[model samples]
Target chain A: MASAGSMAAAPFWRAAGMTYITYSNICASLVRSCLKEPYRAESASREKVHFSVSKWAGGKPEKPNFVPE
Target chain B: MAMAALRKEGRRLVLSSNPSSFARSAVFSEESCPFGARSVSTQIVRNRMSSVKNIQKITKAMKMVAASKLRSVQTRTENSRGLWQPFTALLGDAPGVDVKKNVIIAVSSDKGLCGGINSTTVKVSKTLFKLTSGPEKETKYVVLGEKGKVQFLRDSKKSMELSVTELQKNPLNYTQVSVLADDILKNVEYDALRIVYNKFHSVVQFIPTISTILSPEVVERESESGGRLGDLDSYEIEGAETKAEVLQNLTEFQFSCMMFNAVLENACSELGARMSAMDNASRNAGDMLDRLTLTYNRTRQAAITTELSEIISGAAALSH
Candidate 1:
């Protein structure tokens, strides 16, 4: 019952909707992956494991005994 | 009136006589033909480059996504390997019984373009059907994916239970499998339960693994592939629960977990297969584009040379 004009437009509308849906799904998954760690910790009440913070040795003496005047 | 009519006819005749020459003069005139060809070809090359770059960007993003999924799935598969071994071993230790009624849950991907992952599972299922048929034997099917459901319904002579979950979209959750498992447990009665799914071996290769869940005797028997499942330990009596309750829970839990694991493994296989397929497609597209550009260039060059010869001839004709 649709006219030719509307029929031609239908495919474009459908394609636009599909792309939007796909993008939204991908975005939602990315967001979920991002917040997964925090969500897991809060739900389980599990203790957080910490990693050792290492410091590098001081490079060279600021004054190398031959100081610039 | 005759002179006016003659002049009009003369003009029409002059126009008709030099149609090609007029077109040639307009298009390939004093304006350098090489310049036109060079500019047009450059624009085309630039356009193609941008499109190819866009494709590369998209493919790179997909590759990264596939890698992340592959990592998580591999970890889950390794962990479940330990779980399936003990559960299957326990079943093996159960009393042997004649399995006349068989229900095989053959899992395949809903989506296509996942290489041979689905086909391998189908092949194994077909083999299972051929091997298990006899005069009085009854075999049923519980198909997990759309593809498998359709295929079995068309070709399979036995009754099949199809489970389709709404949550089969991107980032699949455990609910899909749980729904399927519940439906399967409720409707069908089969002495032997076997599941055919792709077991992830590597990125390129996933072996079709068919594991028998019911008829504990089959579980006890080592697989033809000679993969030995370690011996099962006796159930330790926990504080409050009776052995009967525990065993019942364990059985349900094991089945649900196994189904869930199979679906996840299938998803991983599907993605991996698609990723590889797309990778090849993108590469082929690049190759095609290269060939097209070369052809386009050659066509443009030949056009320019023809134009140059025409202009020279036209100038010579004008001088004469």
Candidate 2:
């Protein structure tokens, strides 16, 4: 009842305070980033964000942008 | 003299076509054409029509773009659904969670012109807000995407806790969504999160969906009231208090997975909606363009016929 991938990843990623989706996506993107030029650009474009967000607390505006990760 | 000649020619044609209603037809024509310069009106219609055609061209292009991107987004959404369904199956989806403190996370897009996807999410969130608030029960809103935030600020300003936007301006990935989920988790601590978003069924169909995730303590209490956690007893745990911590971790992870899945679904639906909306706009523009062109042609022909008749009458006058 134990697969190596599941046994190793499920606990580590869950312990990192992240979900399986995050783990899979980060790994997938990490692999994509390691690829050659055109492919790397193609993969990076899929995850890029182009806008800023503002936070409001009880009708009072706060930070214009939260430093993007 | 020319006036009499033109009247006589018109009467002769109307008499030949419909002998009985000739007088009424002449009177109707007199009443209808009170203004001259029909060519000027036709020119205005022609200009407006060309503008409509330009708009149709742009909408057609937009429709093609949406259609092209839809396949990839749809595939992403389908794959992402797997991430949350397993979690939902494990941790019970408490549909109507009536907790003291609940936060409604409404998902939408940053841009507009994609039909009513955003409004529908907001509507569901607002309706849920109304249902979940009372004397002791506290209900707040955490709006995801800027469109929802603008609507929330319009009237439901006081209830909004956090608003995130610009997530859809570029390509979407799970990492960005997880970051957003973490940001929300850090700021807002509530008994449950009622996540509302649009679910993409197909290109032309998307329905509003709401799923509730309870906090660790609530889930523990829920296990006592009812074993809605169908197969929860099979899993082994070390201690009693540790169960809450496990559930806590599970709840947080579940939130991240759910948010990632929801964002992908919302993006897919947005593109699908844009496709249909732009298509409809293009079709309507084509119809209007056809009608306007027909009107313009008829006016141009009428002017030509009148000029020919005047020439004929003047030639007749010169010969006499």
Candidate 3:
């Protein structure tokens, strides 16, 4: 019976609201899937400044030399 | 069902016994061939049915996967509204840009498994083409999706060149849009421009939308916003001398960001469409499998019942 009701109403639902509803749902799902928080990381170079969104890559830093006067 | 199968065979065997002795021998040869052939055909049919049932299992699994993907994407889409709404509102009816020509950059998906998502965007592109392709100025088309490429294949023959089937490699990032924007802007001969895309509305809906990045039509579309653009024109530039340079830079920046946003929006929509389409397909497969299984069981039971009844009758006749 439920299936019969659905069979009768499917065309109407498709015509009236389902079209927009489906389109909107698809868009909403796409947006929700892509957006994300920025990852955390330390700056790699002396010229670089750390932003909240960045993640640090691990590498050895150069040793500093003391100047003799 | 088993009883029915035995009965059908028993009836056939009983019918075979009614012939004369010589006829019975001939009947055994002729009748046995049909019975064996029928059995073989039924077996082949059963094999086909099982293969279809296996396909249904695969489809059912895909449906579950799509459902999970749908859930995650739905949540992400909901949060994106906060990010985009402010930027779009501030964009405020493309400040009156007067140009002899105009172009609309349309983004669509390369892959199609999504239901009507691609079709809706293509339909909008067609409308835009009709709207702009007047005697006043030539209308140019730039399509970002393969679906668009196919849609406009015939239309490309008309006036201005139509770009179709061009797409960036995946894990689609902002850089791809920048490159696409550069390609578009380089070829653009238009004074005014606009972008038409799908705006994410919900898990099941997307609004076919046109947003003006630059247009003189804003006066026609946004009668109220025209007054605001006039007010902001005075304060928009930094110094008198640098006004042109600053305006150019700002306009380019906004254009790039807007274009990038459109591409991202398109990508999300494509995924959603595919997921939904797959979901529906899988559900249909499951329903078909259920029906086939019912038929298979009935057929198998009927065959079994006929064989059982024939054996019982043979035993009674020997005892008599």
lDDT tens digits, residue span B60-100, model 3: 56546656755655554555445445545654655334445
- List lDDT for all candidates, in order: 0.55, 0.75, 0.52
Please provide, for model 1 over A1-69, each residue's C-alpha lDDT reduced to its tens digit, 9 standing for 90 to 100.
224422452323233442222333344445555666769555333221111111111321122111111
RMSD of each: 24.4, 11.1, 20.1
- All DockQ scores: 0.01, 0.30, 0.01
**Candidate 3 chain B worst ten-residue window by lDDT:** B19-28
Per-residue alpha-carbon lDDT of candidate 1 for residues B229-286, written as tens digits (9 for 90 to 100): 3233234664454444344445555666677677777777877876786575455445
As for lDDT, the candidate ahead, 2 or 3, is 2
What ranking emerges by TM-score with the best candidate at the front?
A: 2, 3, 1
lDDT of 2 at A29: 78
Error of 1 at A38 (Å): 7.0
| lDDT of predicted model 1 | 0.55
Give me the candidate number with maximum lDDT: 2
TM-score of each: 0.59, 0.79, 0.62
Total clashing pairs in model 2: 0
Decreasing lDDT order of the candidates: 2, 1, 3
The digit string of per-residue lDDT tens for model 2 on B250-316 reads 7877888898788889989999998997787677667666766666676678778888998999999
Q: Indicate whether candidate 1 or candidate 3 has the larger TM-score.
A: 3
